[model samples]
Target: MKKFLFLLVMSFSLMLILAGCSGSSEDSQAGGDEANSEGSTEIEFWTMQLKPTFTDYIEGVIADFEEENPNITVKWVDVPWGDMEKKILSAVSSETAPDVANLNPQFASQLAELDALVNMDEAVPAEEKEQFFEGIWKSNSFDGKTFGVPWYLSSQVSMYNNNILEEAGLTGEDVPTKYADVLDFSKKIKEETGQYAFFPSIDGSHLLETMVTMGVELTNEDMTKATFNTAEGKESFQFFVDMYENELIPREVLTEGHGKAVDMYQAGQLAVLSSGPQFLNTVNENAPDIYEATEIAPIITGKTGLMNVAAMNLVVPKQSDKQDAAVKFSLFITNAENQVEFDKIVPILPSIETALEDPYFNELPESPSPEEEARIISAEQLKNSEVLIPPMKNYSDLQKAMTDALQAAMLGEMSIDEALADAEQKWNKALQ
Candidate 1:
């Protein structure tokens, strides 16, 4: 592939500029400059391989984008979750930087500082910017310049086993939305079912779903220090302690990865899950029976109502010359129709207007029951469920601290209060 692009560069050099009258000797130098310029015009695209779990939906979307704009060919590469950030950072610092790639929507600030990412305000049509979720789009903006376009929105929803809930004389519809209710219910389920009520597999940031739903903002309004020791933050972390002590969540979740949670859920040993849509699809494929029997609902709220969200952004690299094509592809993928199709497979919020009207989303087909109303009820509620954090510069390291703290709490390695304070101290030190 590199040779093909290089050969095209060689061909262009021998034709136009080399044929011009320069100092004649300076033409060789011109040829090298022209070659570099030529290849930059070729569109290079990268995806984080996140959507592959749902299906080959991303491939179809990319194909449609290529068909509409035939002038540029997109080279798509998938970086796995384990090594995505490290690999992308190294690749961008080298000659292999892509014309466009996926990154954490909030990650733009650091990369922008390195001059590796483009400010989208100059690349995109301003009027079209309103198509995305406001807070999500704001994550990709820094210093008044847009750097990424919101691709999709992910909310942490609660999934429960209807059979288990029914066995305990309850249903999700009858379940409470308040944190206190959940704590009380967890105790009740432990008394009745013997099996744990929830399995919060030591996923750190992923657990933010429960916290955000509880009105606990980890960062203050000024974006400095760790306010996680505050009233709500304390309440949020205490959830782990209460659930664990009440024997609602198993001790193994402290160390087990996501696979463990899936295993238990498939076995019908776990009644409730604080999970994203990815698990819903995983259950569909791996344990089709469980998928059929399971039910989903908006995450139960805190004393004060709130919910946590996850999302992605697509951006054009500043060094690419095919940015015109990159910009077109960005807007194309985010159009309402495309987003809806993409979200149908992924089961997340499509980051565009007029997408929720689709029949597949409004009402989906299910077996042995009335048509399954999609778990998402009111669009406005989903919009309001989002929790916005500032551009976290040391997020990678800070997230590690939070993860360790969560795992410790999940395992009872440390008391929840102690873990939160240790994490807060570790995080604050980095900020300084």
Candidate 2:
């Protein structure tokens, strides 16, 4: 009987051990399943200078995105406008780059050339590409492969100081419509007001865009050779040389960029400021008197009757493990509805055609504000504007060569022909 009791106790102990093992196995499996469901994939997104001002909106976007895509999360970082290039390059080298980033086409092209970006043509469907403006879409491509998705855009607008124009005996009706008319207007405004009429920044990309619009073909059909050394090119360039020599434009144009141009305009030293519509607010904030004197017009054009288009785009790093998630969120942010929402926050125009169709973009205010007029005219111009500077692998080199030639000519270091010829030579070499 004692032996029987001992066997019973031993069997009970064995049963307890077996129960504990079974419970441990079940708990381990359940824990793993929970982790799999809850471990959301995280992606890093970076934007240039869209912070503080756009914090709430972007945070809301991230939150909404997370709710809809419970398996994905976005971590947002805002970099200053000036540091974007260096920061991104460093991150890419260290293998710690953001999964996606905001960039201009020029910078994005450089990365695309280095094979650091994903080719959107292969990753994005054609229908999705159709969502953005055609010119914007084409601008974001590098060597036939798109590397970025276009986001917001701005078409240049003519901002005139009404007081200055009136002092120069010019009415709003006298606004320049063509490149030649711009020269004529500049001469009159300078003669009457003794203030510079226009200061087209030689350091900016505007000159190249204007030259293209004026029919100075920069390259051959395949873009393998430089072709901008012809009579049309020389004539196109001579216009600026004459403006500089005659003092119709600012003397500092060779060194001054867009910022200086805006400062000059706000200080009542300029009769006309050719810039994006958003600059109206700068004038309004910094020089309210001048803002009251400011009037908007469709940007002056050349032979093609089209203005240059500028756009900011979103790009995905090729090395990202979250490429799919990044692309998906990028599409979400740039979709028509979201882009329109963004436009309301800033004075920018959306690159999406359907976004431009929003009533906010379409309905001009009864008593139109400068912004209202600027947006309408700017949007209308986009229908005709081609991407003036299509993707060129040697874009930076070409820009430098052109600017160098312009400076040399303006400073009288070289004649118009000599300057353009030198630029042509440099361009041909770069293309090769």
Candidate 3:
């Protein structure tokens, strides 16, 4: 009987051991599933003022990217344009910046200066970098490092009112193609129709870009000192001073910004509107009659014959753990296929060379709208355009100096020479 009891106990002990092993295997399988879940990465992307307007489009893009990259997910956040700078700076300070951000070169440069952005030169492959326009691609680069990838570009196009032209006894051929002719054209319009030709706002960097287009160099070699206080610079400043004094441009130009120009154009007070083609939609919605009478032309240029190209770029923060994934998304969004689609939605030109070659940009409908014609004109001029004022350190302060000096000259507070000299002094101080 004692021998039988001992064998029975041994058998029960063996059964318990087998059960324990089975449980251990099941636990291991569950842990493996958890690891797989943890392996998938989710990245945050931030865009400026593209939420409600581009929600469906951006969401679809995210969906497509995720479908292809099954292990990665994208979380998109849209910030208001005015709020982006503060928000991005705050995020960077907290080390909680988004994995990717849509920013302009000027703003991105600030982060790049702080070493908070990824070195795109090393991250982007040569073949991929070659896909964008050389000028547009370099717009985001400074100090031998590229911080962002070019996405969308806007080259200014002159939108004139056909009714105003006819009222002024001017034909389409009479529109000015260069700055020298614009003054004469403005005089004709003011005399014939009693309407201002256009408003060249001295606000922000508009005047600075105008001077650059007029062949006034802003800085010397190595950018260590001011160089725009020369003969050409004085001439450029005097041109606007003459306009303001002669009542050719409205007095409101002294106090208002580009928005006032648009308002006046839509209201039929101004004859010409120099702005992006995308703005035609606003005119169409707000003032259908003005929209109907709108005519498109290539932007007026100065001696250099170069147009100003404004670009929006995509950037990855250095703090992002998923740098590769963020860059992949950036390239995917700005690729030829995607950029072409975006161009269709908005009249802005694509930065990608192949995207610009797409038939959509080159070809127009049989009866194209003013916006469509403007798109074509803008695209045709893109090859000759560049970011006139490339990103620079203390660029805003530099612009403000020029603006204040220009305002002083325009208001008769100082002579053109004094204004330029003052601007040079301020710029030199800022450079230091």
Q: Please tell me which predicted candidate would have the highest TM-score against the true structure.
A: 3
Candidate 3 residue pairs in backbone clash: none
Question: What stretches of model 2 exceed 4 Å from their correct place?
Answer: 1-39
TM-score, predicted candidate 3 vs. hidden true structure: 0.90
Deviation of model 3 at 27, angstroms: 32
All models: lDDT? Answer: 0.66, 0.81, 0.84
| Tens-place lDDT digits, model 1, residues 238-283 | 7777777666778786677667887888888888766666677677
What are the TM-scores, per candidate, against the unseen true structure? 0.80, 0.89, 0.90
> What local lDDT does model 3 show for residue 315?
92
What is the overall TM-score of model 1 with all chains considered together? 0.80
Q: What does the lDDT read for residue 40 in candidate 3?
A: 87
Q: lDDT of candidate 3 vs native?
A: 0.84
lDDT ranking of the models: 3, 2, 1
Q: Rank the candidates by TM-score, best first.
A: 3, 2, 1
C-alpha positional error of residue 191 in candidate 1 after TM-score superposition, expressed in Å = 1.1
Model 3 lDDT per residue over 221-241, tens place:
566799999989998998899
Tens-digit per-residue lDDT, 5-117, candidate 2:
43344354444334433443344334421122567778899999988999999998899889999888888999999888777766765557787899998878876766667
